[model samples]
Target: MIKRYTELADAVEHLLLEKNSEFICYLQPVTSREAALQWLAQYRQQYSDANHVCWAYIIGNTRQPQTQAFSDDGEPSGTAGKPMLHVLTERELGNCLAVVVRYFGGVKLGAGGLVRAYSNAVSQAAGNAELRMISPSVQLSISVSFAFEARLRQLLQQYQAALDDVAYRDNVSMQVSVPQDAEPALREQLINETAGAAVIRQVASHSGV
Candidate 1:
């Protein structure tokens, strides 16, 4: 499991020129394949005159991404998009996309030159973008009687869990988000402190940016 990883804080771009060819690289934070594609469409529209719009993305966990895809557009196979993706994975960047727009400058760079151009386009530009750590998390719903409400709250605080929601009725129902790595210890503490009276149900898991 990816306990922590880096992701772009915001969109960034860099331009490189190699052998009279222009390569403009754009790096942005994206959560899913759909989001990456949507951005790709927008960039294509924005740079409609570009000769090529190559792109790559790694969504979700960096160590083991939930989704990853790339396109070389019209460039030679494995020359453009793959090299850009290599730079992203080498940096262990998750939930991000790198798109390169090229303008033909009437110069033909060989495959090796193309790869270096695309790779450097991203590697150099990424230094200008802000990045932050992401911690994967799990959300759980806990139900307990009023008698154990205070103890449950204390346990949640002890584990640095985020109290998402709470409701009072015949019993106290609370929704909380906890770091994935600490879920087991928190669960055990809840069971012990509430004397097994707390009912915990996993709601969903996500990355805590």
Candidate 2:
């Protein structure tokens, strides 16, 4: 089962220092694997002078994580990326990416120190970010009469649904996206409101918002 997940509202930054070495961590919001890679590439290019750009990301639905990847960026075998990945996975974050850019100072942090620094950097950013819950929903298309349009829209509010698309023809055609759990009740309400005139069909399922 998946708990509620949140998106990072804005980019977050955290800094960790060990023996004069500066680790600048960036937490960026990413909804897809492609987006994650794109953002990482942008960061790498922007910080081309930095020592290392270690990164990790979790992309998928609330119920299940789809794709995950982490890179050490030459930090060490098990130091930078894996610890950052652990923080994201343990929190069950959705569509999130964690990148820690290291600017090596004169000192060298050991493997354990690197692990703690990387994990703490991501964790601190997560704490400071604005997270939005990932809501699971189903897409549905409904057909109803023009006269019942207003009522159908009202019923959507009560049924926890959102209106996606609508068309005015001989009758009214609409595409609505409703919560997966509330579909049954929403469908029942539609039938009663339209007096059997409303037709509802499941179109697709969305993993998260």
Off by over 4 Å in 1: 169-171
Residue-wise C-alpha lDDT for candidate 2, range 1-209, written one tens digit per residue: 34446656678888888778888888888878999999999999999999999999888643367788899999889898889988887765667899999888887778888898888888878788787777678889898888898888898899878888999888888888887778888888788867888988889887565
TM-score of 1: 0.89
TM-score of each: 0.89, 0.80
Q: How much does each candidate deviate from the true structure in C-alpha RMSD?
A: 2.0, 3.2
Report the lDDT tens digits of candidate 1 across residue range 51-100: 99999999976678888999999999999888888888888778899999
lDDT, candidates in the order shown: 0.90, 0.83
Best by TM-score: 1
Candidate with maximal lDDT = 1
